[model samples]
Every structure is written in C-alpha cells, then in structure tokens.
Target: MEGLEQWKIQAEQWSQQALQYIHQIPPNQLYAALAVLLFPIIFIFFVRLFKRTKSNTIILSGLSGSGKTVLFYQLRDGSSHQGTVTSMEPNEGTFVLHSEETKNGKKKPIHLVDVPGHSRLRPKLEEFLPQAAGVIFVVDALEFLPNCRAASEYLYDLLTNASVVKKKIPVLLLCNKTDKVTAHTKEFIRKQLEKEIDKLRASRSAISAADISSDFTLGVPGEAFSFTQCPNKVTVAEASGLTGEIFQVEQFIREHVKP
Candidate 1:
C-alpha cells in the first residue's frame, strides 16, 4: 500500500512539471511546437486512410504476326476489324471490354495499349511500363516453332526489364491462334519457350555484368528456367484472337484491372 502511494505521487509531480513547462512557452510558440509535432501524425493518418489507386492500364505486345491488334479490336469492338494490317504504331484506347458490355452493372474502362512488334517500335514499350497493371505477350501458336527463339528472346528481355521486375507486374504468355486444328497447345509452347529461355539465360549470364543490358535476370541460378521461377506472376493461356475466342485474355485483364 505504501509503495503504491509513493508511485502515484511521482506520477503527479511529472505531470505538474510538464504542465508548468507548457505554460511557460508563449502562445504563438506553443502553437507552433504543437503543430510541428502533430503534422506528421496527421499526414500519416491521412496517407493510411486514402490508399494509392491501382492503375487501369494494360499493355498488349508480341511479334508482328501474333494477332495483338486483332485481340485489341476484339476486346473493344467484338469484331476483327477486317483487313487489319501490321501496326507500325501502337493501337491504344480506353473502353469497357466488349464482353462486359452486356453485364448488369457498370464496368470500369481499361486503357489498353498494343505496342507494335516491329524491332524498331519495340522501345515504345518502356514508355507504358510504369503505369501498366499487367502485360500480355501474345505468341503465334500456329507458328510457334519457327518463332520460338525470337519470342523467347523478347520475353526474356521483358521479364528482365527494371520496371517489370521491381514492380512484380503480372505477365500473361498468351498463345494466340488456338482456333486452328494444327495450332500448338499452350503447354507445348510453354515448355519450348522455357527450354529456349533456359539456354538464353545460360549464355547471357556468361557475359560480364557490366556488358549485360537487361536490368534484371531470370530464373533460379542452378535450375532450369521455368515460368514458375519468375518473381512476377507469369501465367500461360490459350486464345484465338482472329476468332474472338479470347475468354482467357478477358479473364486476365479483369483479374488485374478491377471492375
């Protein structure tokens, strides 16, 4: 009982000292000091209360004949925009997906950009990476073998880009043109790409770090390269952009870009 009473007296004395010190300061100075101390607390509270908004941009990219433009039109207009030629420039638009147009509620529009596959036009992809919610690399499934190396190299570069790796942006390896009976399966295309990438990874890692242009590296050091090994979410899906059978593509967009 005596110890408890002594502790209470000490607490009261500290409180009195604090009150005395606060009173001694002039009103203006006191207010300034209080404001300085409270500013950061108030700022932090507001920051937590209002979280950053997610980006609604999605990038569609791939080789020239991979049907990226077709997919873009299909998503926007539900038609193949007949007589579409190779896009020398990016085809971009912000709109609600055609598939969702019939839905009961309103849908959030996505800003979709299809960066052309031409070698000279490839650098434009960097301009959009910062705001991209996800990236879709369309592969020509019907012509997978002949273009596997080129596709793998492009994909390796994309997977190693500084923005992509640092942001951990999701990537969809879309094997397009699955409507044809002869079109390769997504699994086969995935495995071949992995094998090709594994070889590329080995050769690239042999170069001196100073000479390496890619901002990041891919796969585990000692194991074969696999999509699962990517730090970012890498997934494979089949689609036929020419036939408007792009349910998987729509699903990927909806997964990253909220309604």
Candidate 2:
C-alpha cells in the first residue's frame, strides 16, 4: 500500500546517506579510527598477559617452630634477635638484606613477610600472596619424620591454591635446622614429603565435595606425586637458621627480587 512504499523510500534514503558519508572518508583515516577503537582492548590484553606489576615481596611460610621468623630476622639483620616470640599478626618489613648491606645500599630493598604458622592465622597467607615474588616453605629438618604428614598437608594446600598454581609462583622447600647433627638430609625430607602428599591426595579425593578444602588437585591422576609434577617451579634447599647458614635462601630471594 501507499504507507509501506513511503517507509521503504525513507529507509533507502538513510542507507544511501550513510554510504555516501563513509565513501567521503579517506582510507588512512578509516584505518586510524579502527586502531584507536581497538587500542584499549589490545592494551588490556597485554597488561593481563605480561603482568606489569613486578613485586619485590617474598613470603616465608611453615608450621610453628620451623624457623620462619628466625630466617626473617637473619635475612634482615644477620641475627636471630635472641629467638622470636609467637606472632599472632604477620611480621612484615621492607629493608635491604643484611648480607648485602656492605654494598652501601646498592641492592634493592625486599618486602619480606613471615606468615604465622598457626592454623587460625594461616588464612592470612593469601593477603600477601597476590604481590609475592616468591614463597619459601620452611621445614623442620630435625623433626622431619614426626612432622612429615602435617607439613605435607600444609604444602599440599599451598600448591593447590588458585593464585599459586595459576601464577606459577616459585616455591622453595627449605629444610631448616640442618645445624643439628641428627638433622635429616634434604633429599630424605623431599622424598618423604612427596610420599606423604601422595597419601594425602588419595585421602582428600575420597572425601565428599562439601568437605573438601583445596581448590585444585595435586599431581596427575593415578600418578605418584612429586615436586617435579607441580606446575610451578619447586626446589629444595637446606638451611640452618640457628647457625646463620642461610646462603641458599638469600640467593633465592636475590634471584627473584631484582635490584
């Protein structure tokens, strides 16, 4: 009818006007306009991929009496401060390492945090993990056999955390207290931890979903568990916080936190 024909003519006129406007623009301008529109999207993607925020923070974690606080004191001042009292809140500091102080303030300052090992306080670990450059998991080498299962359970939780796993945050399984003559070797401790975590993996799997705690499963299914199986870089090192033999821990910190 007459009304339908008139509406079609107006639509055709609008389409022709748009085509003419586009045709009037230069090809170079069109390309530049398109690029300007896409610039924010490309920049956002690159930011997520490259992680522009490189952190100087390092985290020390372990069960009570694994010498985490002692190591923190040693790294900051090269002394134990006559032993540490139990810290309900995290002990945090930003300072240049004591060993590198001889360089006359040349080295970069580290943002070190010692998360309390108490189960009630362990949840505080995640607050600093987002900005952590590395994680050092202290183990009591002198009491390895007695604490192996508990240590593995704690470490297993760390390994399965979404941030730790997805960010591929490097972990140092530090066997501390090697100053003791009866201290277990790092190799022995590593193997025992792997065995204990393997057992934990199986046991955790059998639990109901509602009772599960870890966010991710450790190691491949039907496979024996090992540090090598972790998505992140996992290394073992020996240290003696009491005797001031923590060279490896310092080296790991320096490697991760650049000057």
Best by lDDT: 1
Count clashing residue pairs in model 1: 0
Candidate 1 C-alpha lDDT tens digits along 88-195: 988999999999999999899999999999989999999999999999999999998999999999999999999999999999999999999999999999999999
TM-score of 2: 0.84
lDDT of 1 at 81: 74
10 residues in a row with least lDDT, candidate 1: 45-54
List candidate 1 stretches off by more than 4 Å: 1-19, 23-50
Worst 10 residues of 2 by lDDT: 80-89
Q: Considering only N, C-alpha and C atoms within 3 Å, which residue pairs clash in candidate 2?
A: none
lDDT (Cα, tens digit) per residue for candidate 2, span 207-249: 9988988888889898899899999999999999878999999
